[model samples]
Target: MKHRWLLWFCLLLPWTAMASTVQATLDRNDVHLGETVTLNLRISDAMTASTPDLSALDHDFEVLGTSTSSSLSVINGKQSAELIIGVALRPKHQGDLQIPSLTVGGSQTNPLTLHVEAPDTSASTHTGQDVFVEAQASADHVYLGQQILYTVRLFYAGDLDGGSLPNPDVNGAELKQLGNDINYEAVRDGHRYHVVERRYALTPHHAGSLVVPSIEFQGEMLDRGNPNDPGGFFNPGGLFGNTTPVTADSPEVKIDVQAPPASWGQTTWLPARSLTLSLQGLPGDNKLTAGQPLNLRLSVDAQGVSGDALPALSLPTIDGATVYPDQPKTSTHDDGEWLTGHSERGFAIIPQRAGTLTIPEITLTWFDVQSGQKKIASIPSHTLTVLAANGAPAPAATTSPSAVATSPAVASSAATPAIAQVAPAASSPTPWRWIALGSIALWLLSTAVFAWLYSKRKRAQASVTKPRIEPTDSTRTLRQAFLESARGDDRAIQGRRLLAWARAERPGLRNLGQVADALASDEQRAAIVTLQREQYAGVSAETRMDLAATFAKGFAWQQDNQAGTESPLPPLYPFKLD
Candidate 1:
């Protein structure tokens, strides 16, 4: 009887857990005075399709919006479905507040608590402030038409989700969101912060104290103890998790702006604390021969600054050289109070002309956060020589061709290199036997030297140029690769690859909604969408053939565009190299 009872209890454990769980987690738990926050309710099992009761939250919170997303997944070979319901809330008042419990199916969640603080209105707030949205303008003052930076930050110490947040409205300034929202883990004020940070690159409109208006948001908090029911406390949800909803608000913030200095001409926008400039390849090393390609890399490192605010670095134009900007990446870190990170930019340069060409000084200028002034750092000019295609020098040499042919080995072994005769062959008349023999030897030596130089230049050029293609080109290439993978009947790999490609390609575009936005033409976009859904075996081979043709056409179009002088692609954004 005891053994049978234990078996039954074990069998019923899972059913008991399934019947009692209704989990809830907000996007942020802390908020400021007027910030809106999102509260998500996740139900473990299927429940009646009805909104959970949130009427108890009327005193401290107001609902702004609600959205729901449901997903079903098979984990460890067990099927499970999750229903995620979200609510946008705004705080009604400041100080501690409580959110009432919510019931889903037979399970209930406990109340949630949050703290809301007033915005700092004092002049003493300096560069740091509590519960404020502040913009780090790269320049306090700039000349008209000069570029200035405006980076907005929302800082606070309360539940973030469902907290009343105000929409950022910068009427006095020109603002542009750099890209999609950036979410990362940050450690601030000795506390580990999991923060959702966004970046934007803004150029002022008219220049002055451009005031970015306050943003308001709402969220939920839990009531600690009920004063009316001292003997019997009422928790709507239960003991396990908070079902209550409360609201919070973020403080209003302002920025002081000014005009650019008149002395600085129409220079690049430089909004940073400090910058480090570097030149990767030294051309003076005699590493290339005529008709051979050599690569040069330029990199910049900026710290105590905003990575997105980095300006483009202009390199000196070397004749017979081709240069292109490589796609850039930026890495940022925030230690609670201030954002401190490095932004790096790299360029690939190919030397086509063979001669001693001077690469002039490369300069990077930015606002010096430490000195509160403008500063510039530069890498001085350098010169390089490109030998003749035949592996011979332009200037005449006195040494015979025979001796010149043997010079390469001697230069490799000896401390000093021997100079050979460079006079015209017609001018120097010697015995035919010596001249013929020496000329043949010189010709053979030149072939071998040119071969080595070509190989070396090829390797160097590949290293530098490859980076320019991979980040942007890889995605388009994957579309074809994914089809190839599926052709081989590799559904799993194709599925994963398609998902990854979608993620990369989606955010890269200016807008989202349809796959056509990613492609240059409507026909190509339609083909890609059809191809994306072909994994279920319902798509015909004829359809697949059409997709393949469409991909080929699209690829050819991309290559044509890339080769043309018109740069349809977006301008180079700020990036960092790890």
Candidate 2:
């Protein structure tokens, strides 16, 4: 009590000249925790300034920063300087707080009251038509780093020019837009309104009362002109086309963001309303054999989160099967106010030998926000049947009189010049018969050897150049290289891989540095430097990039234009004519 009086007395210090009047003000009278409010002291008709005593707010608010400045002006030889002081304060508790009176150079400003409320966790219900907004969450509560759907709905009956909406900037939170805004006609309180709804998947970084402020949108609405004196060529009755300035603001919301539970030990913290994993393009009626490639697609769809937040998934390795995964594709979709995210990845799985192959199940752990418990989403496994090669019977052979008659003629036609040089063994009867039989045997043996070598070569090339897309698409190949490097492929590994890709892409291009200098601008020089450093430098260094997006931004390695790679998963959701 004595300290408060002393601080007020210090602020109320008397001055010899009483030439100034003081006033105290606040940017916001009501605030939540972690929200900083500004307090300003305006002093008019003053010469010099003195700092105000702010010790009264010390018990309730943390003073983040303080500043003071004065404006000086000489108007017709009469000089005046006004001192302005500002302080930033964050609430320390949830209740009413006071900004005590302050005095500076014979000027005393009155104390002001501030209301510090806990985070607002209430669902807003609105039926207004005049450009109003309301916010709601998929779940009222969530754990830290968990997914929570925070949606903002803007309801207006007037014309909207499809005005741009900014992403919400909430404190202590990271948010991703679920998808594009949706506009539709909605009825509320017997009145029709054109609604523009936007949604976001918000993940709170801190465990506390998460207070999200109101979302405000300012835009122009169409309106008829008001005229009593002015008139235009088309304004006989005055109603052509003019726009009025309008604004909409959604109510502030408070969410109870909780900490992870104790039972969820050694699991990822994913708080979501619901989650699902769908595996498309499973082995159908088609028979499987050794070394045969099968395309597989795994898609994960989750509610209350953006697709970007989902963890990367991989198929469990089977000894008999080879797994080749492509880069994952992700997208977010919205159905009205509700949002869903989808991520898909395609894999080329090849069974090494004919046997019963066991593919293991996958499990994803997440917090069930509704139940306030940990939930595990499990994907079922599969046991595939592969046929053996040695068990199949060889094709049967047959010979006839016409076949024998054509044999010598066919051999003579296929014979090379060297073989034709020998005069068909003129000394013996049926001399052409021996020559034909020998030529046929040599041709068959050479063909078998050539076929074996070709097949082996193809398998080796497939493993070395596991193309992200068809080998023909240069941009996709470049993007795949970028994805590989971005996903923590060792620097040395990326260097070799991209070099190999460059050689395959152009066939003639050898020097990557020369290609980079010719094709890319100065902005891309950094990526080139990274490549060189990775190839030559020994110590490990961190490097990151958006491979596909960079390619779109003119980091193109172009050949001739080619079509995009065909999607591995045939349309499982095929359209029906019936």
Q: Find the candidate with the highest lDDT and give its number.
A: 2
Question: TM-scores across all candidates?
Answer: 0.36, 0.38
As a whole number from 0 to 100, the lDDT of residue 576 in candidate 1 is 62
**What digit string (tens of lDDT, one per residue) describes model 2 on residues 444-522?**
9999999999999999887555454335676566657656665675666666666666666556667767557444355
Clash count of each predicted structure: 87, 2
lDDT of 2: 0.69
The TM-score obtained by model 1 is 0.36
Model 1: per-residue lDDT, tens digit, 1-578?
Answer: 99999999999998776663677765545565556666778887653346777777778987876778877788899877777788777777888877767887667876677776663332244233224434455555543333344444545443443444343566754454544443323224333333345554444556566555545434444343355543444444332223245433334444455565666578775555557888776755645675665556666666544555455555777665676766666665543323444555455656654566567888777666456678888898876676777876655534664565566555533422333234444456566549878998999999999999999999987655533233467777677676676566554575565555555555443322233443456676665566556655467666653544554433222222333354578768747658
Per-residue lDDT of 283 in model 1: 59
lDDT score, candidate 2, position 92: 82
After TM-score superposition, what is the CA distance of residue 388 in candidate 2 from its true location, in Å?
3.3
Q: How many backbone clashes does candidate 2 have?
A: 2
After superposing candidate 1, which stretches have Cα over 4 Å from the reference?
A: 1-162, 172-206, 217-221, 231-251, 283-285, 303-309, 319-355, 390-578
